[model samples]
Target chain A: MATAVAKKKKVRINGCVAAAQAAKYADVDVITAYPIRPYTATMMALAQMVANGELDAEYIVADSEHSQLSIAHGASSSGARVFTGSSGVGVQFAYELYSPISGTRMPVQMMIADRTLDPPGDFGSEHTDALSARDMGWLMGWSCDAQEAFDNHLLGFRIGEDRRVLLPQMVCQDGFFVSHITTDVELPDTGQVQEFLPPYTHPYPLDPRRPVSHGPQIMPEQGPPLQLERARAMEGAVPVIEQAHDEFARIFGRRYDPWLEEFMTDGADVVFFVQGAHAVTARYAIRHMRERGAKVGLVRLKTIRPYPTDRVKDALSKFKVVGVIETNLGLGSVSSGGVLYAEACAALYESPTRPLVVSFMAGMGGEAIVLKEFYWMTNKMLDAQKRGAIEKRTHWVGFEE
Target chain B: MPAIEIQRQMLPMFPSPNQGARFYNPELPETEPFVPGHRTCAGCGPSIQYRMTSKASGDNTILVGPTGCMYVANSSYLCTPYNVPWAHTQIGSSGSFTAGVAAAYEAMIRKGKWKGAFPNIICEAGDGSASDIGLASISGALYRNHDCLIICYDNEQYANTGIQASSRTPYGGMTTFSPPGPTIPEAKKLFPKDLARMMAAGHPHCYVATASVGYPIDLMNKVRKGLNHKGASYLMVYTPCQKGFVYETPRSIDLGRLVVECGLYPIWEWNPEKREFDYSFRPQNMRPVSEYLKLQGRFGHLHAEHIATLQKFANEQWRMMKVELPAALIRAADAKNLVDMASAEAAAAIAETV
Candidate 1:
């Protein structure tokens, strides 16, 4: 076993390269792409890999994101392990396909380097692009850095293609933060990935011999049942996610909590709740605050849907206050803020010692929440604890007096 | 060759029902590829085409439906009518999606991932989806020469959206968006775009043809011929919409025959191997234009002069197909022979109570 494991090579690469490497390592049969912001580099790298004969794949340069997803769906339906990606409005342009792809159970994997949607066409990182597709029955979450992005891409395939959970995945990372930022992403050898993720074999594909209908028109009565099936698949994915992460850790020697990532919250008084790359920054801020005698920590949500509700309740129940750092927009939402605030507060509502949760609209519109903003948010949480209630429903971190 | 010899030699003598009232549904396979019990309206002409198309492809087939009534109305709430592996593609991605499916199958069969005879990959696009939004993608797929069959189920207008005018809608057709008012007597002034002919002319190498629901056997044979072709093939079929045409639901198949019989819809194929047009299809009877028009509400507002103009247009279409016009059709094209609906005193006297 030791010798077998030792035969697998590991090399350090950047996130975009790591994603392309993972796709190559998985021996993807088809790769569809359309150029957009941070995600374009991944396709560009894969295109070169195909040209160099490193990967034997059908590399299709699609006309648009809509075409990209459609091609991916078509290829995957024909029993090819397909890969594609997009960023920002590119994701939205293919919105008509998300439910159809998932409903057909194609198990197509889409890597999204999150970019803010335009009114302003800013090519900066924001969760809104991917977050907007949260309820589309896709297995979606964000990766903090390059290594995690690579592992998540591999794991996404396993979880998505699993017969019990035949759904597409939006394996995402923040634009420029993890998408462009270089990191030491340890690339797993082909043998390791083969052991970690078996080749995709859809039970009912578009095969001539064993034919089956996909994404067929359903009657009204049938709609609820299929939706229930999708819901059950999502709920059923919780155990599969944990099992996948456990298996991934066993194979690659990298451990991660599949749902909630807790940091220094054993005896902390206040915890900053967040997701994505901002969690790494918040970790540094929390450590600095700990040394300065502040009992503030962080709880980073790794998976947004099939949201780790119980884990979140247990992790933050000891804290007196929980501040959700929303890095995306929710223009006319209940909090007059972001969507995570509603989810975080809703999850905590069932807790025994439901902490006084406050939504801090920071890191929004692709503006990274800095250490100073973290400290400021913690002070607000501390004041809420002193006052025994949230001062307001939302707080604009840097803009407010 | 003489006209008599040409007609006698070229036309196949399939026995027509003696009563001229009997409808003959071709003997189809027992296989239910596209089954019944979907949300398509009571008598969907396109659904009829779909059933025929799928039946022709047999069991080893993959169907692609672009965003259209067939995808929406047929697949609503997830209760599928298809017994085979059917996929819904984007309206514009019909050709491209079908291309990918074909490519995947080609690679799979070669690589031994899928072990079987190659499945027939077919795309069914509505006229609105085909002639408009999806035209370029369809052209691209044909240009790429993917092994697939694309059928544009042309129902003249966009029927699923409640009868909006598509590029294939006929001249003076009264759709909701193209309603006739006092100022604009003819609702839609322009004639329908010659889509099938354009496709044939554009992609000469492809097996391009025109079929209608009026001729089910001919349509099915064309479908088989397209699929049997090694590379890409395109077929544009005239499928009448009862709601859109404002005609009786039972007359759906009748209208298909009437359009062709009146020389309004030409049925021909572009033989890619020979680089020639095969005008081998001939309707059972040659009817006057008024016999086809008086049945639909869209043409009800036509004046005598307008009807004569349509008759002239039909004669020209017959001339294009090299079909010699009978003397009656030539005389009908004259405006003096046409009768106004409001001034038909002889017809009114026949219906008088006295």
Candidate 2:
């Protein structure tokens, strides 16, 4: 068994190029783009792909993010594999179209290279852009590196376009950390991608041969059923995502946990709960802590949309203390910290032996949680466990006293 | 990979079943894409325009409704009047969504994914959506030259939200937001944006035209013609609103004609090929602006001077259309020949009695 990069021809590329390469392999029919850092780099690679005759597709430089998403939704509705992306507030700019794209069951794939929101403009990773639209019925997840980013793009298309789970997907990566930084990515052969992802054929498309009305204004009574259907699609995507990963592994030779990736959690008492690219750094920190016999592990959340709630609860229940990482802003939210802390708290609340859950506002505004900070956070968790009562609900990392 | 050859032909335009000189109602498709049974007001001008536009497009069409009267009124309670594939988009998404649909079909057909002649992608945006919020988006679509028809159904006001004045609301037009008060007698101070012409000037490649429900044949023909054009096409159809315009429901079509005839609404097309204005379109007879305004209760508060101002505005429209102004129309523009509406005077007189 070869590593994913070793099995195929690996190329040193940034996250943006990896996304474009995946779109090329997927044979995306339409690529709508609105330039915003660092997602703009993905569009640049795609523009070159179209220009070089590498991909026979429509590359539309959209007027705005709202237009970009609308274009994606419309393209998907017309039964075409559409790819589009945005970053930071640009994602929020197109927020209005998110629900309609999914509600109509258009499996449009968006590459969100995370960036901080406005006022003090910063081109850095923050999950708030994609996380805010989590409940919009899109199969959402984050990639830890360029290789996983490429792999996730392919897998996202396969799972989203599945007949049982017709939904849009958000394939996210950290802005400068993942998008701009170059890494080794194994570009799969076109034949393998073809086998994994079938040509998308929506049940009800805008076709003259078969006329069907989609996204019609429904009755208030009908709202529940339509919502339930969307919920079912999100819920239904769990097995489909698992199947996509299994099939993806068989074809591309990269096996990944579809929900949570537990790193050295065996007989561990405390675990760090995180998502996106930070997990890569978290893995190194966990290994160092394990070497020191600190009994600390890492739990990387993969699919955040369908949430894998039961899986999360089961996995976190094994640990004595769970330190949730807050990378995105959620003002006035439960836990009054990042958005993920609330989700983690709720998932762990139903546990019989609830872990001492604490939120650490780390890696926000694109600052990486360094090795020393991880150790400091682990000590805080250890103190909470030793005292048998949590010191505080949340820690602002460097800011907190 | 082999290239697929899709048959590209215009849907043969047939003459009106009642082929009378006037009211020559073209034989509309029996398969109503915008069907009855939905809650559009009786004699809804925009609704009529919708039915006509969809009919012209036939079954092989995708209607994109922006947030406006058409979206709220037609597709209420999950019951869409659209039998053909339709989707509602944000008000400002009118052009972008339609562009997407058009772009999708282009890529799909070219890539040999979806086989068939390209579906007629159409956007039925309200005046507010088109003139204000969605202007830039529609401009973008037209500039990109997406093969779609974006019809800005101009009812002048935001009819769905209880008649607020939109950018398309004409000078002296009264609405809930533009009521005549002490400070401002001319309810809506600004002139209506020449949206269709702006579209034509900005995106010259697109086929742009102005039509009204007043001329059913012309409106349907323009719809078909716009759809026929390979590139983007914009048609701003003058849809009279009974609720917003404070006009009699039965006179919806009548107002349509009156508006055009009085030169308030000019009927013309922009020939993208020739890069010229097609001023060949003409109403039957030029009428006085007073005659057009008198039918609507919204204009009941207008004084003689306001009516004269409207006549001046109408004169400018006629001049823009290159139509010779009739002596009577010129005379009406003078304040000497005008008087305040009797209703306005009656209301003014009843102040103390009340």
Candidate 3:
């Protein structure tokens, strides 16, 4: 579909810059911005890009995060490719627009550079800000590194803008970890990106030529069907995500597992389960543990929404123990620790051989999960596997004895 | 790359309704963007304003309705009276959504994605949204100079939420939240916000004006003029609420005129080019505040002193407009000249019990 194949190049940039580059390569038409730390870097890069005439897009500095998302919704409703984002409490401030945007089925993309929510205003990475919006019918996932963050943004637009999957996407990365850490990212040629992601076109935009009313008040009886249709759209995206990842692999010469990226699980008895930037640390920890003749491996989850329940069950059934690293706070959750443990245990409940699952609160407060902490979590998982049962369901990685 | 040509639409301005002494309006646009058969009251003031505004903007328009009576009553049971494209936004997302639509057209037209003249983007916000919750968002849209019109159909209270007080609720007005009490005898103690002037003062680049549903031709012309303005514009039109104001349904338009005549609602425009107020628009006659207050039951509890307070407030508004006040209008601001409302005693007795 694309004719002008430019040369591909690699650049050393942070995750925020990678997101800006992805938006540029995708040829986004409208971008709404409101400054909040770490996500503000993305908007800064975009502002310069627009000024340099590298990207011809309508860049609006919205009054607030609420206005930012509202602008994105409006632009997307008018059949424009929109990109907007926030961090920390900025994400929570625009909480009201999440359901409305998704309910309208506008495939607007938001890049969330994850940051801690308030109570003293910490600017570290935390999943609670984005996890709070998981039930709002948006496609959500996390990227572990700058390169994956770049690839995920492109894949998010391609999949979310698909006709069958017209839901918004929150492509999340850690605040200072991936968002600030510079890494070598292989930027794609414009022709390759154009071929993968087509020009955005909604079936019914707010066009005067083709008049249509959107989001009118519906009767109580007519409510469920619309909600059911939204549900169907989200569920239908599972296959489209797989197909897009396949196409991405074929065209970009980069292959990635769509659901889980298992490393060193060939002959392992226990595994560390993680998402986002902490997985990069876990992989190094796994290599160190293997050299000491430990049977620990790593399983990094790529997508969390439309969560891969069957794949998680099948993969974890091979392990004796699965340690879920939660960089988020679930204050009064089921395991009395983090929220991921409950989801992981629920998915493995139907598995024939369920692994003894435990949650590890590591890499919290935007602190990196050092190799020492990862090794401590592996030892705790090994203790659970050897005893054939767990002591407590959760461990504060740095705080526990 | 060479500069791309962007095609813009310039709508023809309507002729003035006053043709010598005839007082007959000219032919209006035939495109009925807002049709009948929706569930508004018998003589809904906002519904009347919606009809006139859409009629002026015509077919090439996109209407954004934030959460209000216009959004709820006009689009009920999955049916809408709007024949043109309409989208419902959150109550606080009034300006931001309209800005998004305007920006989308700016980019889409320049990029050759959409092939047509830019559509008129209008946000119909209520007084509650315009003066209170969504104020900053509207200010942001205007400050950014988006090519759109933000109209605050001022009904004075939160009419859709069963009559509560908003920042635009006039002094001495009584809604469910602002009921007359022994301690608070005047019902609502605070004066209504000067919303339109505030818009003009804050964003001097925007064309800001005030109109009423009473003057249909003037209101329609202002709507067109706002649309014709090259940048963002604001209009705060007074639309009397029959349900909230507790008035007879047929007097909706008459109440609009009486409010302006009594000096309770000022009509003027903020000329951005001259950076001054244009007060040439005048009502047919000057009257006391009672002529407007006596018609609505919300002001039925006003005593003689309270009436003087309201008259003094109206007189101050007249002074700000630089209108020459009549002796009779000035004399009416004294407590000795006015009498208590008919039900003032009984209302006070009831108020003391509650």
Candidate 4:
């Protein structure tokens, strides 16, 4: 079979540009932007795309993040595909819109280039920003690289806009590691994107032709059913997400495990559970450790929100030891560490064969989890496995011996 | 990749009530975008303004109700009064959400997706939203020139939250947050913001006007004119609250008229085309501030000096509009020439009893 290299157009670009390209290919009708850190690059790319006649969309530079999300919500409610993005505290600034956009069932897609929350104003990667809104009824996930970020944007729109799951999505990536770092992403043809993602259409939009009232005040008794319906839609999205990914793989020729991505886990006793861009470095560290006859592997989580509870339990049950790498801050959370540890432990607690799970607080304040830190985290997990019991629930990486 | 002939709806302007020798009620659009059977208080001023604005916009419209009296009272318990396509937005998202709807329609029509005339996009924002929290959002929408209308129903204070002082609350207005005290007899010390003029000055390209629910035909015509405008338009309406103002329920329309006649709430249009103020729209007759203030109990706490200050403020507003103040109105600005409200004695007796 001929490789057909001539047909495939590959471009070296950052995650921000990849997201903009995905939006352009998706042919979004409206884009609302408010500049913050690394996420601002995506808006800049989108602005240029609109300026150069490359995309026919209404690009509004909003006054603030709150307005940006509101504009996206309004456009989505009016039956237009909306694309918007923010970072760090900017994501928190628009926190008010998260619940309403989802509860109203507007499939507004927001690209998040994750940055650490402020105090010192660090522009590095941290999952806390997007993770903080985990309970807001949004379909959330993290992409490891520019290519995955591009793929996730298109996939996010398709899944979120699905009739069964008319909810907003947070397509997130690490701030500098993926958002600023350049990588070769194979851009798909317009025809492929068209076949993969249908034009966004809400069941009932704010159209005079139809004349439907949305978000009306309801009686106290009506509140439960509405919330239950939203819950049903969220829980019902699992099947839709799988179907979309299957179609995406068939049309785009690139497959991704919709829930979790397992790498070199064969015959390994200890594994690192990670998310986002840090998985790229974790893979390298695991490969190097495998050469030294160290039985360490990587199990990277792709989706966090309609959290794959069954999948997480099944995957971790196979290993004797699991080291949860949390790149977020949950100050008073369980394990006295990040929130991911609690999710991992809770997911595994129901499993018959529970792995001795330990939380590692690495990548705090947007600092990268270097290969050395990964090795250190692995040693702690190995020690726990060797003793047949864990010393502590969490260990602060790069802080402890 | 083709030429799309976009069609837009142009609502017919209602005739002025004061057009000729006799005042006549102009025939209105039959479509009741804001219907009955809601929780708005009896003779609610904001509700009247909402009814008038939505009636003017007709059925081919989308209303963005921010967190305010219109959204809370009108859409209580999963029931809504809006017969047109309406969506409730955040208090601060008034303009941005409206802009989004406008942008969506523009793109949808241009892309040949929606097959109809462009619908009227209107945002019914409370004074709290227009003057404070949502001010920047409204300004952004106007500056971006989105084809929409943002109407700030100024009921003086935050009437929805049981009467708190907003930036648009009058100087002598007494609210829950600005109660009359030993040190602060005037209650609210600050003057009301010139919201409509601010909209006009900030976004000079937008159609900015001040209307009162008192003049139904004029208010309706202004709504039509705003929809007819190519881009963003702002209308700050004088909507008196029965609960907050402590006025009689049936006197809502009367208070609206009296406020304008007293020269406190100026009625004018900022014409973008000529880049000048259109002061042609005038109240029927001039009245002293006491006549307007005495109708509402919110101003019952005002002393003679406070009344004088308010009158002076109104005089300055009249001067700003280049209107000549009558000699009697000028004399009323002095504290010596005025007396306290008749209820002031009763209020003092009650305070002494407490």
Candidate 5:
């Protein structure tokens, strides 16, 4: 629905810089940063923005990501729109804060340029970093490209800061795929962003005049009610997310399905179920395969936590087989390794004629699942449909048998 | 003095109902700045300190709980207990976060984003969080002179993560990691880091004080004083943990008094403007270190020598505070004079042997 609006200005920039530009356009009030690869450029851009007087904000170069989030948590509680980002292990390094920030309902937004977890020390796009934190009460999702990344950053603020949702957001994009890649991302004017997202104001913020104790110690029996409240909030966020996206479209001329992005899934015999930049590639593969008259499609999951199980089950119920592409490491997990396989299988367990799903370790270590790999995965799915069973639990896309 | 006239007032024969020892939770506004139903442990002493702290700050207050037990346990499950606005900072970000909150309020109030008399910005940090991880950041906030109050609830050990020895943990105390064994007889051999005094000595321009929960009125009064101070103020309060201290829950406040009376923890304030220590406050009685040690299992393993060493340390603390020790206290400081486990033979030895 986005229209070409009055000859857009073009600028050459990387993914990190684009994210920084999005944060700048969002008019973030406080920026907390700790240097880590890929995502560091975003903070570096913000630092320059602060220095050049392009952004009138408090730029805090924190000692660590733990400190960075704490600063953001503090700043946001003081009613400032805060921006922070981390990459790979840097995200894990700050794992301690994920729940505390959300629990306090500070609505802090963090941009994570997904990097492969260490052991081999590869600085590449992988979902393992952010995926590890999916269960921590944060609104987590990944963007497929730079424009989506930019849009997601703004939407994340809107969704997280919404009174009904009041949760922290982990807006992720692949490290090199989206974080380093350059693309034409239309920058919304400040007025449009303002209309799309209101200035964050918590009802009971750390205001001295109306002192409230945030995150105080509670007894054991008291824990369930609070957790139930958080659960209710997550479940309640469905309509809010839709309304936010609808509002974003009305104001910014960019339309997005709040939950799942489906491509040629109607009447498809097999579908690729996945998230992030690889979904873009899968879509391309789907198009190529469809041209050859092989009934194939893609179902890109936009939101992971608050996991959209009902919508996913509805979408994939008709398909004979579903291939799950996992760009993450699940170490010793079931389904021969990847985590999404478990999530997808579990989500489909109660469905009528549940699809024959096979886990594909296609994007492990950030290796791009090439066109051939997609075709290979699709063939595996097709084989499962025809044979009524899968030969193996998982298939490493690029590596030989 | 007129004893007859004093008696004519018909005071209660026992401790009077209105005596200083009695606790009356101030006629606090119905507003609960720090509300109940948090994730803190049952009978948590530090949480009690937080409750008292926020109650003193009242409606117009911003609380900053740095990363520690308070931030973790209290704010768990995304349900905050704060009726007012409270934020959690990193264990090390207490001072800096507080400074930001204070700065934000100053700018907001001035810019008309908010309109009110400046709210009391208070940062409540645990001893481990404050004295150890957060010391430099707190020092930075104090040095920057932010209009805030930073209270280090000194429960000695890190109680939230089970009992662990913090820099503020006293000598001869037994923590999980600092257990008493045959070789290392005195569990924690090193003396506690003189944290509050160090804060006062380092940040002389800021209002610095040491308080205990035993003196609630004094604690509340100090909270008000810190809020009223034009610049940053630091208060390291002795809030005993019944769990970590291995004492009866009801004795939590009692330990606070015993800690000060034993001279292990001194209660005083530093007058920034006058540039002097105010030793105006005093405990009711001076007691031996054993009186405090006997209450907690952490100090149970200490031998006579260890107790004497602690007593010597307490004597040195008394001297630093310029408190003139009585002869009894000086006699209590000597190892030989102090009663050992088998020392009943010294006097009144006509005992039936088991």
Candidate 6:
């Protein structure tokens, strides 16, 4: 069921600006942020929006990342739609609040422009920052480009604000790559956005007339029931996520697979399983590889939380081998690889005939996963399929002897 | 863009504590925000302070209790005693979390999103949390002028953690962490920080005040005044810790009164409207420092010189409050006028073995 599209203006903007535009269009009630690289640009854009009077909202420059998240949580709990973000260790700095915000079921949206966590002194994009919090009861995913990042922010609001699934969302984009790169982003008409996403209101807000205790300390025995209810909300978000995406596509004419994006899996013997902007490069590499009569494709993971176990199992089952491009750091993992390898391998563990899965640590430290590296990773997977076994479980793509 | 409408609250600006001269129950909101059947001690000062604060806040309130006795004991085994909305934040997040709640309400109530009068957002932090780890965050909240109230329920030391000495712990006071030892005979070497005055000096615009659980009506009134200030406010209440102070359970409120009377805890308010410190508060029946110190076992180890040192400290507090020191208090301020702790036998007999 599709509807007539609205007037869309094509504007060239960076990923940070795209996210700020999405936040502005969403008409967020409160925006709180602390300065961290890559993600700081988004706040800069938003601050300018507020300064220019283009956005009528409360923009608070928090003392720290912890305060930013706290402000976001408080604002959200008070029945205001709030937007805040951090990058790198800035994300880790606010680690204590991730659960409290989610546990309370306040739909706070955090725009994460992934930056390399420090000690290495790099400002490139890496998934580890947001990936580390994937299990913290937040709905999270990545966008390949600015347009998707913008669209995802809108979809995130709808999905998270739904009564059935009132959870916070992490709209992540790669640092510098998607966040800094300028592209032609189609801005939706304000009326169309209004029709798609309306103003947010929490059912149990801290209202003088209707007061409710949120995140109250529960007894040990009472813990299980509340946790189970939170689990239920997450599990229930599956239908809500699917419905929102379907509705998002119909209204905005931008359709996306809410969970996993399949680039080319038709009759492929081997494929690349990647996430974020790395998948965009994987697409180019796969197109050239296919022209060489190589049966290779790409399986880009969009949603990393409430992980699409059944869908991943079905789509990846058709391949003979899968190369998991982990743009994140997951030390002591099953594949001695990245964390995504475990999720991909777990979904395939119960398969009738599981493919040979190999981990390739690439696109880390904000370094681009070049076409040659994709070729190198593809050959590793193809070699595994032909040998019917992985020579090794994980490969540090450029480090392998 | 449409003209953003300004919403004025119809709620009372300050708390309406019932006026009385005697120890009568202050007219409080009917709703028991701090319900009974909690695990705080029989005469826990902080628990009593919690009751008064929650009563002042009423139904439309959100309480942020940093990790402390109020957070752990009051909500023991997940059995919360709160009738109104309450949250537990990290010890250091006392002010930051409260600032968040206050800022949220500001946007929500003003943005035509949330309806009704603004709810009171209050943070109840322990002395250790407020005067120690949470000082900067509290300063930040006050500096930002968020519409919230930050109350440091000062039990003198970190009583919840088995009486570890905190920055607010008085000089010569004994705690698990500051026991009288060979090198440090006076127990805690330094004087207690003048926290309320520090907050008032740092955040002059805030409605800052020093209060005590001993005076229920005044404490509740100050709580209301802070909440009604329409901006950030800080209150530090002298909540006696029977467990830590090693006093009789029944004397918790009595200790609260003795503190003010002895000038150890002078009650005063910072008037932001006139940008002045209102030192108009006066305690009835001024007593010497010995009257307050002799009641607590923690100070029982103090010698004549130590007690006189405390008296001197109390004198300083009175001077800051602009109160003339009484003759007995002035005499007690000198070691020569005080007995040598019965020639050191009391110090030897009362020194905690720990």
Leading candidate by lDDT: 3
Can you give the DockQ of every candidate in the order shown?
A: 0.29, 0.53, 0.63, 0.60, 0.21, 0.43
Q: Tens-digit lDDT track for model 3 on B1-354?
A: 332456766777677651111224447877789999999998899999999899999999999999999999999998999888999999999999999999999888888789888888999999998999899889999999999999999999998998889999999988888998778878999998889999999999999999999888889889988999999999999999888887889999889889999999999999999999998888889999999999887888899999999999999989988989999988999999999876767665533432
Q: What share of the true interface contacts does candidate 5 keep?
A: 0.43
Q: Please rank every candidate by TM-score, starting with the best.
A: 3, 4, 2, 6, 1, 5
Model 5 residue A266 CA deviation in Å: 6.3
Point out where model 4 deviates above 4 Å: A1-7, B17-26, B342-345, B348-354
**lDDT, residue B136, model 3:** 88
For A1-401, candidate 4 gives per-residue lDDT tens digits of 10111235999999999999999888898999999998999999999988877788889999999999999999999999999999999999999999999999999999999998986469988889999999999999999999999999999999999999999999999999999999999998777887899888888999998888889777789899999999998999999999999999999999999999999999999999999999999999999999988899999999998999999999999999999999998898998999999999889988999999999899998998889888888888888999999889889888787
The candidate 4 chain A region of ten consecutive residues with least summed lDDT is A1-10
Q: Residue B156, candidate 6: how far off, in angstroms? A: 2.6
Residue by residue across A101-198, what tens digits does model 3's lDDT show? 99999999999999988864688999889988988999999998899999999999999999999999999999999999999999998878878999
Q: Per-residue lDDT of A1-401 in model 5, one digit per residue for the tens? A: 01112334556676788788878877677787889898999999889877876765667666667667766777777877788999899999888778877777778889999998886458888898999999888999988888888888888889899999988899988888888888777776666776787767888777655656666556688888878888888887888889989998998888999789999987899999999989888888889999998899999999997799998888888899999899888988988678999999888988987989888887777777789989889888888989999878888777754
Query: Against the true structure, what is model 5's DockQ?
Result: 0.21
- The TM-score values for the models, in the order shown, are 0.86, 0.95, 0.97, 0.97, 0.78, 0.92
Predicted candidate 6 versus true structure: per-residue lDDT over A264-297, tens digit per residue: 7898999998889888888888999999988999
Quote the lDDT for A94 in model 5: 81
- Candidate 1 residue B193 Cα shift, in angstroms, is 3.7
- Which runs of model 1 end up more than 4 angstroms from their true locations? A1-12, B1-44, B66-83, B88-93, B132-140, B160-162, B197-205, B215-218, B246-254, B270-288, B308-337, B340-354
- What are the lDDT scores of the predictions, listed in order? 0.82, 0.85, 0.90, 0.90, 0.79, 0.84
lDDT of 4 by residue, B1-354 (tens): 652566877888765553221223447666788889999999998888888888888888999999998888988878898888999999999999999999998888887778888899999999999999999999999999999999999998888888899999999888888877778888799998888988999899999999888888888889999999999999999998888888788898888889989999999999999888898877879998999998877887788999999999999989988889999999999999999874556654433321
CA error at residue B107 for candidate 3, angstroms: 0.3
lDDT of 6 by residue, B143-252 (tens): 99998999999998987788899999999988888887667778899988889989998889999998888888788878888887888999999999887887788898
CAPRI tier for the interface of model 6: acceptable
Per-residue lDDT of A244 in model 2: 85
Model 3, residue B22: distance off in Å is 11
Judging by DockQ against the true structure, name the best candidate: 3
Interface RMSD of each: 11.5, 5.0, 2.9, 5.3, 13.8, 5.3
TM-score of chain A as modeled in candidate 5: 0.96
Q: DockQ of candidate 3?
A: 0.63
